[model samples]
Target: MPFENICIFGAGALGGTIAAKLAASGNVDATISVVARGAHLDAIRRSGISLFEAGADKPLLANVTATNDPTELPPQDLIITGLKGHQLAPAAEGLAHLLKPSTRVVMILNGIPWWYFHRDESNHAELQFEELDPGGKLWRLIGPERVIGCVAIQGAEVSDPGQIRLSNKGRFILGEPSGDISADLREIEALLNRAEISVTLSERIRDDIWSKLMGNASFNPISALTRSRMSDLMADGATSDQIGKVMKEVKAVGEALGANVGISVEERLEQASQVGPIKTSMLQDLLAGKPLEITPLVGMIVALGRLTAVPTPVSETILALVSQLDRENCRTA
Candidate 1:
């Protein structure tokens, strides 16, 4: 069977987009389920999953299953955990009983994944960064075997619980966490492609993830701390230079950890420059009075520096600045 019953762990912006496309493809036989709670759940259940199909001004609604309790959902073939970083633990908690042996969980979160380099024969292989998976809850519950790493470059946000505004790029890079091709990976790629979303099946998924992380770790926190946009930050020579330092640190850490990301620091910076000025998701979270995904986004880089015996001068500095801002943001709100 080709994954007829799929359940999304979160019913926010990204989940809605994926649900709409997957439903449209006729890949799955039944209605897709969106696991949610309270107002978000109510809105989705009552109004259906809505998205800007191909960036249209209006939303395209698809009939979907939305609910608060996972127990109410059947054991599904696929479960994509489209959650904020902080929501990982809770999602896992709910998932313990909801997933079956056949279900493959696609972890589509940003920043350093908890299972990176887990089975590699490198120096930093098998070293689990406790800062990201502090209690090892995610690591233990969701094994490396079931995970497919996603380098999600798309940008969309829930304009409200009922609708999601598709604002920018919708492409994502996918790979098995162990960097090996398998049946599940192929199935997912086919489903995504059938749904009209751009996906690249990557061999070096970790490197692609690290590349995006370098920009995210440096740019996201810096933007939030200074309240600036991408163009202004990339335009100023000094700021851009600071970002370069952070990327250098990221490269050093990745190299020491035995994951060879073969991109020069300046090349990475140039790639980030071409993306144009866009507001980061972290800033959106802050303005929405939600907890920032600081630990996984920026903290894991600093944590990796310590694990790999590398000096992270720039990442450390940026982490400190962002940490202070996050603390203040939490304190007042």
Candidate 2:
């Protein structure tokens, strides 16, 4: 059955755009709502969510119910979290009340998710990063079985409070942690496809997660540090060399976890360079004074390397620098 009540939690740039697309699809058969705060929430409540895709003259609109309080809302059949990795913790307690027994949570964020190591067969449960989730709050609250992995490859940002501008085109890869396809997964695929958004189901979601993380963990921090675009990062031999080294370390970490990324460093760099002068989400966040999503994008890779006895010196250095920069930004905020 199609999901009935849906909530797009953390209705920021990517979240708002996805919500708008699904709600405006006219075939989803779901009541779409969004949990957002501040001016964005007010704007969405007033005028719905606005999206301007590439090459669009005007904007696409989707009238979704917007709220800051999830407790007052009905239980959701599906909860799509669009928050950054660092923003998940504070919102977890509130979201716990919104989940019914059969509710599914699709986390569409970049980097290593909090549930990455939940059901691994290895004896590395002790290696779970407390920094990502202190006291395993999200894992215990939401339960890994209800969690679905999503690798979102699109670049989007909020031009204003209620406006989302999506640049380029990309696809979403969704899968269960156990590498099995289920009815709900197929339903999600159908919903996104109907909206004219690309979606795919993966047998091994972790491999795809690592595949995207390899690039995110490599380019995002370097872009923030250098204040450079993707083209600039790829053009400089030294900068691109650092990205390649970091990606190699990430590949080793993924392999140690039994998920091969299956792509060469050169190929990844070439593909990224072709994206032109696009600014990474990390760099955008830094410039906007928002909290840098360093933990999952960069820190988790470093932590996983430590667990697997692989060295990630390049990523580690980038993590330390970007983290300090984030701390300084927060200090003045």
Tell me each candidate's TM-score.
0.92, 0.96
Q: lDDT of all predictions, in order shown?
A: 0.77, 0.87
Candidate 2 segments whose C-alpha is farther than 4 A from its true place: 125-127
Residue-level lDDT tens digits of model 2 in 140-172? 798878888999888888888899888877678
Which stretches in model 1 have alpha-carbon errors above 4 Å? 53-55
Query: All predictions: root-mean-square deviation over Cα?
Result: 2.1, 1.4
TM-score of 1: 0.92
Give me the displacement of residue 43 in model 1, in angstroms. 2.3
Listed per model in order, the count of residue pairs whose N, CA or C atoms clash below 3 Å is 0, 0
